[model samples]
Target: MTVGTIRPGGRTARVRAAVLEAAADALVEGGFDRLDLADVARRAGAGKTTVYRRWGTAAGLVADLLADMAEQSSPRTDLGSLLEDLRANARLVQRTLTDPRQGALFRAVIVAAAGDARAAEALHRFYAVRIAEWSSCVDDAVARGELPGGTDGAEVIRAVSAPLYYRLMISKEPIDEAAADRAAEAATAAARAGVFVRSAGAVE
Candidate 1:
């Protein structure tokens, strides 16, 4: 079974929740550089040895935290209009990147992924899950004839949030409602223009 597949009972589940919460706090407070297993255990009120035995390493703990986050993430919106659904997704991304605690945590994780292989893989997995969930919106769009029949749902989904992420990670600009709306509009227009249509032999 996968690391997150097990359904621990009662105390075990509580302990895991507490530990993961502490780990997120640590990341938000000081980033990945200061994420220590012992410190997280202390913050969680769990035994250091238990934390060490369960998670083994800071990177391992971070990976599990990301897995848990993926599980807890909100479901995709299903507004009938493709543009509306994309706008909802863009606004969700905008809100997350602009929120105080969530923004800090995301920045810390993103920074960690930049320098650590495990963190990078975990980050990729997280985005992959999110993209899959939101791709349904594009699928719906294709069914509604809003986009080309061969439109790549995943690509359309990625286009919606890519600009918001760029602002959060690269441009250091403000991620506001306007930015989110613009991103949604741009992606919707491109999708309508068949920009995300899958070509023959395209690796999906």
Candidate 2:
């Protein structure tokens, strides 16, 4: 269903989405540290009592917002081959980086997460969910003997796009198709080189 068509679970979920949508708008306009729940309530046209009753604090609101983001995110698809799958994943990240709304929202949340434990945990969960979803492609490759049996699916997934995020945040660089291709190539080469493969009894 489209975002506009989505009906939240109940009153709380509805209130929460409203609050988060307001916060997201503010995030795009400014940054997370500047986000005030009271302002959000005002912008959302939600009652202060309801907002406080549901979220308790600004951190709780941010955590809920992050959770909503993770839930709304697109699911990863397995396209029969690792190269194609990684390309799809790269393109997904590239699209996000290029998106006016999403990129600004992510940067705001990430910057706030640097100092807020709640935001940090929420952001961590967001990445963890995304990684697990895409890592299935790597796992499939190993299962098909395209990669070594002991390959680390999670690391391969992370290796592909960590630099994309780095460039987005650190250098404020544009993540173009060329960047996405390079990311996919680097990750694929590492997989080919067995960089993610775990040797037997490698727990040491």
Summarize candidate 2's per-residue lDDT along 1-204 as a digit string, tens digits: 012123658976676667788878887887876777788899988998887888887677778788777777888878898988998899899888778888888888888799899889988998889888889899899888789878888899999898889988998777998899889889998998899988788772
The Cα RMSD in angstroms, rounded to one decimal, for candidate 2 relative to the true structure is 2.2
Give each model a TM-score. Answer: 0.94, 0.92
lDDT of 1 at 48: 97
lDDT of each: 0.90, 0.83
TM-score result, candidate 1: 0.94
Candidate 1 residue-wise lDDT at 146: 84
Q: Which stretches in model 1 have alpha-carbon errors above 4 Å?
A: 1-9
Q: Pick the candidate with the highest TM-score.
A: 1
Instruction: Give the Å shift of residue 144 in candidate 2.
Output: 1.0
Task: Give the least accurate 10-residue stretch of model 1, judged by summed lDDT.
Answer: 1-10
